[model samples]
Target: MTKPVGMEVAVAAAEAVALCNIDVAACYPITPNTHIAEHLADIIADGRIDAEYITVESEHSALSAVMGASGTGARTFTATSSQGLMYMHEILPITPAMRLPVVMGLGNRAVSGPINIWNDHSDIIMQRDSGWLSIFADNGQEAVDMFIQAFKIAEHPDVLLPINVNMDGFQLTHVVEPIVFPTQAQVNKFLPPYKPFASLHPDHPLSMGTLGLPEIYTEAVKARDVATVNAKKVIVQIWQEWEKQFGRKYEPVMTYKTAGAEILILTMGSMGETAEVAVDALRKKGVKVGLLKLKLWRPFPFDEIRKAVRGAKTLVVTDRALSYGGPGGPVCSEIRAALYDQPNRPEIVNYIIGLGGRDVRVEDFMKMIEGAPKAKKSGDAYQIYGVRE
Candidate 1:
């Protein structure tokens, strides 16, 4: 039986992982993400879930341990945030290259320099090309739901790759909401026991993660690239299956009031809800504005993006992370590139907002939308919202 209960998003995420019957959880303590690892430890300590919680020395070791466990065919899980994720940078690319289907819960936070701990997309954005299937959750419900769906998507025979379920640090992670949890039987039915395509066993001896010489290095990387792109099919299939059973539909690009609108506001992560409120207010005032929330970050969702912005004249793209020295933001740059060859593409106005846990209010969204027309052109530059003079 599925039950709805008010819970903190971090706890709810840990609960979702517990329901998946993961075999090993090796996570280090990091801000915003610590609660998840702590709760997982409690669950294992309480014997609620028969899983091994490996205590590691650092975030690097945390990922390394999970990799070894996953290589041994264990259903592995891990969680991290901010610098912790950066610490795992070396292992990030290796995991996908080795085709390990490890699932991780990323509490999205700002990367350090002056040392701040808060909500932002900078952390995850740093690993954009690491070849992990990244998905963002707009709220607590989506966070819980995506964690459960991640295993199925990653372990699919067609897509044996790692996945990162991203939720805003402090914004989505620490907040409490009414999250619906599927029953153990329901989870079991949806996600059967993970059957590894290959494993490290003594009897069936086979080499894994062997050195890639110069001759085959290009082909090796090409194979991984193709695999990442093709994983979209399995991801959608798993999402559809989840909807069929749980009644919550998910798509790569989730739209709100986009029909027949000439202007669209694009956002990712938890700010989508805030943008939705702005959209409703603008619509009430007879503005033809809509909201497009990106859920699937990697593999880029090119077709859905093209379809969503088809008739819009202007697209206001809000990015939480700034792409230094390059385009205004990573997402805005990608959106421009995706629509470059399209027939009638909209003018993109990029704004890097809510960096380092800055609050982005509904009125701020409204101001951005209202002021977008007068803002600089698509390639001119990006505006940093709410910066003090």
Candidate 2:
């Protein structure tokens, strides 16, 4: 399978982390993730890819030089977006409580004020609790297969978090598709090299970002929320072994025909491809509707979004970014808290739509799925969509 046509899903995400043999990149550039660190510093200056790029300056020293070259184990990676991910919001909780499986590429932007660039997700939605394993890609072949399955579920020794691979601004990083660049012998028989169960050893040296009080700081933040809820079962067993070596099955939450739908839209990056042509033109004008697509926003799948809006009667969602006064934004307040304990739950409708890079076309998701029956019975928490005076 070969198909790297006109490239630039940020150089097919630095050629899929140099075919997953990454060994320290530590970058510093933010755009659309600065053309994926300028095409991985020209594939580490044409040595063909041995790694060790490290051109740091600021996104907090490019995540403090990939948390000090992934704490001397080194299989790191980097890329940023929007105010350089809020200027690395204080080492994004010290690279997953110093676990350091640092694989990033969050080119989704739109987090300025009164001054704008493009796309949105409020810069990885303010690092949603900074444990970082946020994924969200809706194009460019799921942002080069979620940066190679977010470094095999963030260096999975039972998930050592710190994986963020969003894609949006300039729509999937200067949008050019037909990806499939997998074979470096199938990404070296599916990503191997990183073997640091625990690192930084000048002969057994440790002591990283310490200072835990309050009786071991609530068991070190409950072992980083049980390693981010055991990364939802180790990201479904590394996405079922990356769908048996890249057949692709990415469903940390994705649905299309919402079962027996009576309308369900919801969305994520690239407006879920303009809500998949507004769910096939409102299902060829018959309009039963269905969509949902949120490829993992933090550890918030919420049981596959409560079984894809459980027999929907109206779902909607659709936020781009806006939580200022706070009503509906961060993925429609996590899809209204995953259907607020659904007992026949449906009637949800947020809709803030395509800010800054605003042009959510396809007839603005087919006039918001043909007004989803009066904006889901108008119990509004939102409904902004291409706002004006």
Candidate 3:
């Protein structure tokens, strides 16, 4: 059994990638995300992992290189942050359309305008419609475990799609934590060598990512959508297998102290951990408050969310990214749509918080929970927490 070791989450994620024995990693350095690629490069340089580390010029080139490599049946990996992710936007949809299972470690960061280098969901939320399976980690251990599981889910025969394992920029990436690194043998058992369902080889030449003419463009898009929605089954199956092998269970929607609760707060990423503390404190004070942490983002877990929010009188949905001129935050909008038709659906209140790595303490979560009822009564779509006039 491998013992827990003190390691930075970024390095631990690199180690996890190494354990998977990927064929190639196309990387470009960006803040917070740089450490992951740097460590992976060091591992490759030291001959610890026999993988090709391609130092690309930009995030666009990095993803493009991985797409080309993955097309040739290579188990490809990559990492990027806010603006870097934006650079790869052009090729993002193409990778999934071609059914390439390239796994990416997205160091979640704020998008640039004011040029902030901090943690937020803005980067990942922007790519929500990119047709990739996206999952979030609340801590370092989850980050490591999710990286290992990502490849398996992406490379599954029934689900040949790319995936993004998102970890908060500085919050989770730069922090040191005691993480249990699974032995290479254990990882090998959990995630076997990736076997591509199709490959671009001269021996048996086939076309991929070709122009979808007006004749079949809609059909082609529909097919990709079907494949993405269908991937949830394979994703769950892989997660269950990982749990059986490693004893760490993962679910789409995770609940805390939710039994008999009248009000619940919903969150994603690392903020869930802070919300749990608030839930415990409120529970001790005879308040009926629970917490829901969403792990799976793409192919959103509609059923699981409805079940979790059932019987609750109110749900305070927190968003780390804003929707700008839209209804509210992207997350709040999705939750509202998910619970719209359900009978006896709880009142969903939206609170935008923790953008650009702003500190969201336990008191903040407590305040949200305590103030949810009034917020719902006010009839406002959403409120940005801690915003100054």
Candidate 4:
């Protein structure tokens, strides 16, 4: 017997935290991301859940606190965005290297330069090599579901890595849409209290987070790298389990109506929704085009991407962040790299779209398709979309 549920990212977020029954929540407020933390606090205050709510002074401290708390064998949670995420960059490495399965919600926002508060992938992209299992959500429902999935995958003994569930700042964070929030009993049955395999203790505490010799340092780093690289398979497995229990399906990379398409468009995070509009319009006009939405970014599904993009005539990758001198876009570079080794790989084009929360109309995407033919003639890896001199 399923009960009725509503949207509101804040409420959905609160329900996720409550369902996980997190033992520790160390946080500092930031726009868009603040509501998630606020709602969790309210839920805790009302005696809805018994969890340690640590009001930290800064994002760095917030992550550091979670690093320590999760080290002590407690399931932990936190939320942040943009500058807040940037502030915790230093501690991001520490959380994963120490093998804490802390789940965080990154309400994706544009990193500031001239002072802006819109959404972008810069913040998460900056932490690209930070060794965390990064997952991007296309909507509010994935945002809620991925967090629950993060805990299970991250805490797994085979993949002890921190995970970030990324959602667009104002877009998904503020927008209201119906999301199926799991009951406490279901959540309990799904994700139990995190029992850490390794920890800092006195009786068995040999030495935690100690500096390793140069000979051992590289191996230690590779272990984490291999774990992240292998995480794609684990991610798919976990999603299947999640679907089995909850009756909702998700894949590390989702292909929309691409079974027999000639050209495929790739997108990540929130832009995938906007791309869906373009896909529909193109399909209506008898264009053999489709979409590929990338959900797992950190432990990138390279093999999956290569297989998916095969047989397509042209592949257009729409990125939200620029890589500068590489393909001019982060997602484009990764996709290109993934297909570079394939003999039958399609001609790929990269387009940077929707920066600083810009409105991405379906026509803009149509323009990208119009420009794709010339991209091969020009022989450049990418072209900035919707940019004017």
lDDT measured at residue 152 in model 2 versus the true structure, 0 to 100: 80
- Candidate 3 per-residue C-alpha lDDT over 1-389 given as tens digits, one digit per residue, 9 for 90 to 100: 67899999999999999999998999999997999999999999999988899988999999999999999999999999999999999999888999999999989999997899999999999999999999999999999999999999999888899999999999999999999999877888888888888889999999887888899999988998998999888888888898888898899999999999999899999989999999999999999999999999998999889999999999999999998899999998989999999989998889999999999999999998888888888899999988897
By lDDT, rank the candidates, best first.
1, 3, 4, 2
Best by lDDT: 1
Report the CA-based lDDT of candidate 2 relative to the real structure: 0.81
Q: Write the per-residue lDDT of candidate 2 for residues 1-389, one digit (tens) a residue.
A: 67657677888888888888787787777777788888888988898978778777788887898888888888888888888889889889889897788998878888888668788777778778888888888888778877888888888888887888888878778878777777888777777767788788889988777888888988988888888887888887777888887778888778876667788887887678777877887787888888888888878878888877777777778878778788677788877777787788887778888777877888888888788678767776887876886
RMSD of each: 1.0, 17.8, 0.8, 1.4
Range of the 10 consecutive residues with the lowest summed lDDT in candidate 4: 1-10
**Error in Å for residue 13 of model 4:** 1.7
* Model 4 lDDT per residue over 336-362, tens place: 788888889888888888888888887
Q: Which ten residues in a row have the lowest lDDT in candidate 3?
A: 184-193
Candidate 3: residue 275 Cα off by (Å): 0.7
| RMSD, candidate 4, Å | 1.4
| lDDT for 141 (candidate 2) | 78
How far is 40's C-alpha from truth in model 4 (Å)?
A: 1.2
Q: Which stretches of candidate 4 lie over 4 Å from their true place?
A: 1-4
lDDT of each: 0.94, 0.81, 0.93, 0.85
Task: Count steric clashes of candidate 4.
Answer: 0
lDDT of 4: 0.85
Clashes of each: 0, 0, 0, 0
